[model samples]
Target: MSAKSRKKNKYNFLMRMRPVLRWVLRLRSTPKAIAGGLGLGTFIAFTPTMGIQLILAVLGATFFNLNRPAAVIPVWITNPITVAPIYTFNYWLGRHIWEGPPLTEVSRQFLEIGRTMARLSFWDIKDQIIAVLSMGRDVLIPLVIGSLAIGLITGILVYLFSYRLLCIFLFRRGKKRLLNNN
Candidate 1:
């Protein structure tokens, strides 16, 4: 994309998130709390806990006394639009780490299993296990390890970047207030 188009896209994305973010950025929390919460959320986003990431992030933020929204919002990183790519990459990274079937083979098997699963009833627990096993050994092991590796690395980077940016913003705001008072 062109630079202008990219910037517009970025702006649009932010505007979409404004509702969820309107208060968090305005909160008078410390950089550590905001950044730490963001980091925690980032790590959790990459985990296999798709359905419970937000809850986990919120609980973690509460336990750690971090900024709640900062922790919770990042969990949206694993939303429907992003889930396929994230999980696929996780599986790809995992296979490289743990040694397994190639990406194409595993992805094909996974699709077949997914199709079977769609027709399956919730009561068919045994059938589910068998279907999962048909692809899990190749997908599960690598996914777990790769998810952890990516989560940790990405979380730390997010924390550091957010901390620095927050610090700068707070410093400038404080200085502006001081100048106005003087």
Candidate 2:
């Protein structure tokens, strides 16, 4: 596609998304609830669970008494294009913080185990599964720890910022409507 066409498509897509953005920003839920929901969704997105972020976000929102839409939508921050980089960074941060084995060593051992699993007889499924889970545990433990720390910090900051912004925006909007009615 031509550069101009690509740009046009981008613009069109953004235009189409405008109403959705407006609705989210102007949701009738209390600012604190909306902000909390967004914070919860963002926290879930920081974790390594690629497929279940939305479910986690919704569950968190429901349990925490936050806005569902706000919670669910922010999880999209970790999309297909961004997942690899984000997860890689999270893993690196995890290793640094939690004292895991070196990435290279873990990767090499994982590959060796993978090859062994492939050579195993189909009847050895339990052993193969155990090997896989062992490698996964080595990686996942640190990652989960780091993600929890980062997600909590990020969630709090996002909540504070969004809460203030939402409060100001809603206050102004109410005043504007009141003026219009006067």
Candidate 3:
């Protein structure tokens, strides 16, 4: 398809999703539960796992007594559209927190492996594993540490903010109901 059509479709999809996002934010549930769920879901989102966020969120919510729907839904924040930037930021943050070999070194090793794979000269499996491990050695540690730090901070902040927002919403709704009854 043409680039113009792709852009138009993406824009239209985003427009359609806006209302759904509003509905999610306005979801009617207890303040504690919704906030807890938000915190849990957000925490899981920051972790390295991309494929099983829903399952992780559900299990975390269940284990933590958070709202199931609330917890599971927000994990969509890490979809393909946002994953690269998010992970890049997380990796940067992790590097700041803990020292690791430079990304340049890591990238060089990764490219070497790619070149080997492309040539298909029948490199030993051990060499491939070593190349991968070297790549991971520099990236993984920082990513994990940074993700944990970002997740914990963001989750706590979201929980607090969601709790207050829900409290206000419920209070206003209750006041309106009472006024109507009068």
Candidate 4:
């Protein structure tokens, strides 16, 4: 359990997994399909919704004729570790798109409201709820629009980049094989 041994073990595990990863990547599919799959997968990954990655990827792949596996792989980008930052970015982008004012003061107001909620009587709580409800729409509307825009732009970029990269790799490899056979 020493730190050095733990590091070595982790490295060994990854090394062992390399072959499986390579085989998955080597599945017979056109480069364009693979690229589209990767792009779509990455795009879907940004959504905060859970348990939908594979379903989205499959549907997207079928509709777009992308490589299912490629499209699915990048969907893990928004997993537990990255979710917070992703959501924060999405919220900020949404606010910007909605032309909303900064939320710093509003967030402080929310924190204060939460702190006071326990001290408030029933009537006070009702008033607080009314206040929040009135303000919530303004804050949320921009967030939704911004997140959708970011997801779409990111997806398209991922698709184009993946497609181009895969194409170049395949083309170069094919040329090398051809030249070697001569």
In candidate 2, residue 65 scores what lDDT? 95
Least well predicted 10-residue stretch by lDDT in candidate 3: 116-125
Stretches of candidate 3 exceeding 4 Å from the true structure: 1-22, 25-28, 104-135
Model 2 per-residue lDDT at 36: 97
Best-fitting candidate, scored by lDDT: 1
Backbone clash pairs for candidate 3 read: none
Ranking by TM-score: 1, 2, 3, 4
Off by over 4 Å in 2: 1-20, 104-135
Q: In model 1, where do residues sit more than 4 Å from their true spots?
A: 1-22, 108-135
lDDT of 2 by residue, 3-100 (tens): 99999999999899888767878787999999999889889888766556777888889999999999988798866456545655666778887777
Query: What lDDT does the true structure give each of the candidates?
Result: 0.79, 0.76, 0.74, 0.68
TM-score of model 2 vs. true structure: 0.71
What is candidate 3's CA lDDT for residue 46?
84
Candidate 4 — worst ten consecutive residues by lDDT sum?
109-118
The alpha-carbon lDDT assigned to residue 6 of candidate 2 equals 100
> For each predicted model, how many residue pairs clash, with residues at least 3 apart or on different chains?
0, 0, 0, 1
Q: Candidate 1's residue-wise lDDT over 45-114, tens digit each? A: 9975655677789999999999888998789887544665676788888878798778887766656655
lDDT for position 145 in model 1 = 85
Give a tens-digit lDDT track for model 4, residues 40-131: 88778765333465677889899988788887788877643454456557667787667665767545544454444445554453554454
Task: Choose the strongest candidate by TM-score.
Answer: 1
Compute the lDDT of residue 8 as modeled in candidate 3.
Answer: 100
